[model samples]
Target chain A: MSLSVRKIVISGILGAISILLGVTRLGFIPVPTPAGHATIMHIPVILGGVLEGPVVGLITGAIFGLFSFLQPGAPFFADPLVSVLPRLFIGIVAYLIYVSTKNINNILALVLAGAFGSATNTALVLGMVTLRGYLPFEVSLSIGILHGVPELIVAAILTVILVKGIQRIRTSEDRPPVS
Target chain B: MELTRNITLGVYLPGETAIHRLDPRTKIIAATMLITLLLFIKSYEAYGFFLIFTAGIIVFAGIPLSYALCGLKPMLPVLLLMWIFQFFLYSTPDANILFSWWIFTATDAGLHMGNIITLRVLFLFTVTTILTLTTSIVNLTDGLESLLKPLRKIGLPSQELVMTMIIALRFVLILAEELDKIIKAQMARGVAFDRGSFIQKTRKLFPVFLPLFINAFKRAEELIVAMEARSYSGGKGRTKMKTLHMGRVDLGAGLIMLLFTILMIYIIISAAPQI
Candidate 1:
C-alpha cells in the first residue's frame, strides 16, 4: 500500500528527532554504567508506532538504524547485523504492545509500549552483538542489565508523558471545526 | 549550546573536484559496494588496501584530511573502549595468550579481532562521510528516487520513502535548534541539568522532552495541512523540475570503483582470516 502524506511526514520528523538525538547526544541519559550512558533515541521510533502506525514506526526505525550504522556510536555497531537489523523491531513491537494493551489502560499501555520498545532495542542489539562475537555473552548480559533497566524506565516514563502531551495536541488539531 | 555545529552527516561541502562531479547514483552504489566488501574483510591486507583506497578518494575529492576526520574525534574514545573490550573478551580455542589479568585475558585472536573490527568501523564511517560530503541532499534524494524507480512496480513506495528520508535530513537541524532552546529554557528556570544524580538528571529531561515532542507534532500538523492544501498526492505522476544525467565522469568513477572492488576481493580471498 502507498504511504499517505501524513505517514511520510510524521515518520520523517520523528526520524529527524532520533537522528538529532544521536548527533547532539541529547538522547544519552547519564548512567553509572561502564558504557557511560543509556539511550532514549529509540523513543521517537516508539512514538512513531504508537502515534502513526507500524509503517511509520518501521521507517523511522530504519532511519535511526541507518544513522547509527553509518556514524556508529560503538565499534561493533559498524556491523549492520548489530546496528541495523535488530532496530527494525523497536517500533513494530512498541506499536503492537500499545495496541494490544491500550484497551486495558491508556497510561499503562503507554508505559508497556515504551518499556517493551526499549527492551526490544537493548535485547536485540545486545543479542546481535553477542551472536556476532563482538562481545562475550557474559559481558553483554551484564551490560544489558546495567543499561537496559535505566533505558527501559526512562523510556516508559517519557512515553507516557510525551505521548499524552502529543496526543493532546493531535486530538485537538484533528477535531473538526464547528460550523 | 551549539548543537547543530557538530552535525556533519547530512552536511554537504560543495566542490568542483572529480569526486564531487560524479553522479550521486554512482557514488551511492560505490559506497554501498565498499560497505558490503568491508563486511567480509577479515584480514589486515584487505583493510590496508581499503585504507589506501579511501584515502585516495579523500584526496581526489579535495576534502581536507583533518576535516574528513574531525567528525570522528568524539568517537575515538568509544572506538578505543570497544577495541579494549574486544581485545580482553573475544577469544577462540587454541589461541595464544598475550596477557592475563584478573579474570581478563588478551589473546592473539582477540587482538586481531579488535584491530579488524576497529579498522572496519573507521573505514565505514569515512566512506559514508565522504559520500554525504560530496553529494547534496537534493541530489541524493533525486538519485535514490531514480534508482529505486524500478522497485515501484513491485509495490514499494520508493519515491515516498525517499521523500521521508529527505524530510528526516532536513528536519534534523531544525529539531536540534528546538532542542537547544528547550534545554536553555529549562536551565534558565533552574533545572541545573549539569549537576544531578542519575535519576535526578533523568527527571529533568521530562520537562525538556514534553515540549520538544509537542512542538514537533505541531510542526508536523502544519506541514501536513500545507502539503494537503497544495493538492499533494503520492509520487504517482509527479515530475521533477530537474532531471539527472550520468556523464563521462560517472563512467570513469565506475571503472575506478570496479578495479578497486576486484583488487579488494582478490586480497580478501587470498589473505588468511585474521581471527
Candidate 2:
C-alpha cells in the first residue's frame, strides 16, 4: 500500500545514515576503551524501529549489516552470521520492547528499548564471535563489557531525546494551522 | 576530519574497459566467486596468483593503481592490529617459536597466518572497489534487480530491496556532506572537537549528532511526502525503462571466470597450506 512506500523511503534514508556513518567514520566517537571508539551506527536501526515498525527496522538493519560485512573490522564479522543475522534482530527487538512498554511510560519505554537494542547487538555479535572461536570467551566478554556498556548508555540517551523530538513534530503536524 | 575525501565506496569512476562493459550480473557473480576463493586460499603461491589476477583486472579496467588503493590508507591501523593479533595468538602445535613475551608467543605459523589473512583482506577490498568503480549505480540496481527476480517466486520483494540499497548508496555522500556541515557549524560556535580527552571528546559529539539526526528525520519525512505527492507506491507492476540484456561480452567473461575457478580449485587442491 501507499504506507509501504513511505516506510521504504524512511528506511532507505536511515539505511543511508548508517552506511554514511561507517564510511565517514562519523559514527565512531572516541571513547577511552579497548576499542578506542564507540559506534552510533546502530542508533539508526533503533530509530527506525521506534518511528516506524519492525519491517522498516529490519530493512534498515539489513543495510547496516551488509555494510559491516563488506567492510569488516574484525575477521569474525566477515561471516554473514556474525555480521548480518544479529543486526536483523536489532530493529525487531527494539520494536517489541517499545510496543510492550509504551502503555506503562513513554520515556521509560524509549530508554529501555534503546538500551536493549544496543545490548542485543553487543551480546549477539560477541556471542557469535566467541562461538565461532574467533576470540576466547573471556576475551570476548571483557571486550563486550568495555565497549557495550558505553554504547548502551549513549544509545539510550540519544534514542530517548530523538523519539521525544520526533513525537513533538508529528503531534504539531497533526494540529490545524494557527491563524 | 575531511571524511568525505577518503570515501571511495559507491563512488563510480567511469571507464570504457571490457570489465566495465560486461554485464553487472557477471561482475557481481565473479566478485562473489573471487571472495569465496579468498576465504579458502591458504598458500602463498595461490595468493601470488591472486595478486597477479587482481592487478591484471585493475589494469584491464583502466583504474589507476593509486586510485584503486587510496581506500586502504584509513584501513592500515585495523589491518596492522589484526596482523599483530594473528602474530601472537594464532599458532599450531608444531609452530617454530620466534619470540616470547609475558604470556604471549609469536610463532612462524602465526606470522604466516597474519600475512595471509591481511593479504586476503587487502585483495578482497580491492576486488570490491574495482566492481563499484566500474559499475554505475543504475546498472548495479538493474543488474541486482534482474538477478534477484527469480526469488520473487518465493514472494520476496527484491525490487523494493534493491531500490532501498540504491538509495542508501546515493545518500552515503549526501549524509556525509550534511555531517561535514554540522561539524563546521559546531566548530563555528567554538566547539573544540579535537582538543578534549577521549571521554570528553566523545561527550562533545552528542550535540553534533542530536541536530544531525533530527534534521535527517525531518528530511526523511519531507522525502516521504514528496514521494507520496509523486504517486509513488511499492514495486507492484512497475516496469523498467531500460531492460537488461546479456551480450557476447558477458559470454566471454563467463568463460574466463569458469576457467579461473577451475584453475583456482586445482591450485587449492595441489598446494600445501601454510598452517
Candidate 3:
C-alpha cells in the first residue's frame, strides 16, 4: 500500500506535535494525583485518525510511542510492551469510533472518539505495566482512574475543537470557490 | 518561555569522533540490542556493566558527560516519583519489610525493583540520546529506510513509514517554535498558563491548542501541495542521491558491540536476581 502525500505529511506534523507536547511538558496537564499529570499527547494521534484515516493515525501513534520509549517520562514506559505497543491503537480506535458514530451526531462522535481513544491508551498501557509486573493491579487501577478520567475529558474536548478547526480549513481548501 | 532550550532528542551534535563516524544502521542496531538486553537485566551487576559500556560510548563520541546527561534533568522528578512508587507499592512474598509508615510499607523486594527499573530507564534514555546525538537526521533516515527496505516484502510501506518519521523528526523543532509562540501569545492575552485550578488550567490550554492544530494543518496542506507539484510518490522507483556504505569503522564497531552483548548476556545469566 502506498501512502499519499497528504497522509505522510499530516501524520508527520501530528507526530511532531505529539513529540513537542512531550518534550516541552505541555501535553501533561498538572493533576492532583500521585502521577501528577494527565497526558494529552495522544490527542494528535486521535486527531490524525479523525481528520485523516487509520493509517495516518497509526503512523503518528508509532512515532509518539517511539518517542515515549526512547525518552520515557515514566519508568515502566521504558518497556516497549508498556509504551510502544499500546500507543498504536489510540488512533485506530479513535477512527473507528468517529466513523461509526458520526452519522448519528458529529460532535458526539468526536467526543466518543476522543474519550475511547484516551481510554485505550490508559487501559492498555496500565494493563501491560501490570501484566509485565511493573505496577500492581491495585496501583494500576487507581492511577488509571485518576489519570485516565482527566485525560479523557481533555481529549474529548480537544478532539471536538481541533477536529472542527482543522476540518474547516480542509473543507475550505478543497472547495476554494465557496470560501 | 524558552521551550526549545532543554530539548536534546532529535538534535544532532556534530562530531568527528569514531562513534560519530560509524554507520547509522550500526548505531540503530546497537541501540536496539542494548535496549533488549536492558529488559532482561534484573541484577545490579548487569546494570553496572551496562553503565560502563554506555559511558565509554559517550566519551568516545566526544559528548561532554554533563551534556549527555543534561536532557535527564526534567525527568529527575518523575524518576524519583516512580522509584518512590515502586518502593512503597511493589512487594513480593518472602520479602522483608524495609520500613512502614501509615498505610504504606516498603520492602526489600520493592527496593530492588525500584532501583533496577529506575536504572533501566536511565540507561535507556542515555542510549537513545547518544544515538540521535551522534547521527544526523539525514543519515538516520537513510539508515532506517535501508534497514526497513527488507520489510517491504510484507507490504508494510517501509519507505512511506520512514518518510513519515523523517517528517516527524524535522517538524518537531518547527512545531515547537510554533507552540512557543502560541503560548507566549496566550500569555500576553492574560492566559496564566501556570496558574488556576485543575479545570481552569486545562481550560487555558484550549486557546493554545486551537491555533496550534489549525496552523499545523495549514502547513500540512502546503507541504502536500508542494510534494504533489514535485510529482512525489511513495517509494516506488525512487533513487537515492547518495547510497549508504558500511566501511571498516562499521566492522570494528560491530565487533565491539558483539563483545559487549556477549558479556552482558553472560552477566545476566550468572547474576542472582536481586529480588
Evaluated with TM-score, which candidate comes out highest? 3
Candidate 3 per-residue C-alpha lDDT over B67-178 given as tens digits, one digit per residue, 9 for 90 to 100: 8888898889888999999999999988899889998899998998899889988998899889989999999998999999988898888988898998998888898888
Error of 2 at B174 (Å): 0.7
Alpha-carbon RMSD, each predicted model: 1.7, 2.2, 1.4
* lDDT to native, each model: 0.89, 0.84, 0.91
In lDDT terms, which candidate is top?
3
- Comparing to the true complex, what docking class would candidate 1 get? high
Residue-level lDDT of model 2, residues B1-275, one tens digit each, is 68788778899999888998998999998999998898788888888888888889898988988888887787677678767877887777899999999988899988887887688778777888888999999999888888897877788888878888888888888778888999999889999988978668777887887777777877878887887898765567778898778899999989988998898899898874434
User: Candidate 1 DockQ score?
Assistant: 0.80
Better of 2 and 3 by TM-score: 3
Q: Which stretches of model 1 miss by more than 4 angstroms?
A: A174-179, B272-274
Ranking by DockQ: 3, 1, 2
Give fnat (model 2): 0.47
True contacts kept of each: 0.86, 0.47, 0.84
Clash count list over all predictions: 0, 0, 0
Q: After superposition, how far is residue B186 of candidate 2 from its true place, in Å?
A: 0.7
- Identify the superior model by DockQ, candidate 2 or candidate 3: 3
Measured on C-alpha atoms, candidate 2 has an lDDT of: 0.84
Return the clash pairs for model 2, or none. Answer: none
**Candidates 1 and 2, the one with greater DockQ:** 1
lDDT by residue (tens digit), candidate 3, A1-179: 88888899999999999998998888989999987789999999999998888998899999999999988998889888888999999999999999999999999999999999999999999999999998889999999999999999999999999998987887777785844
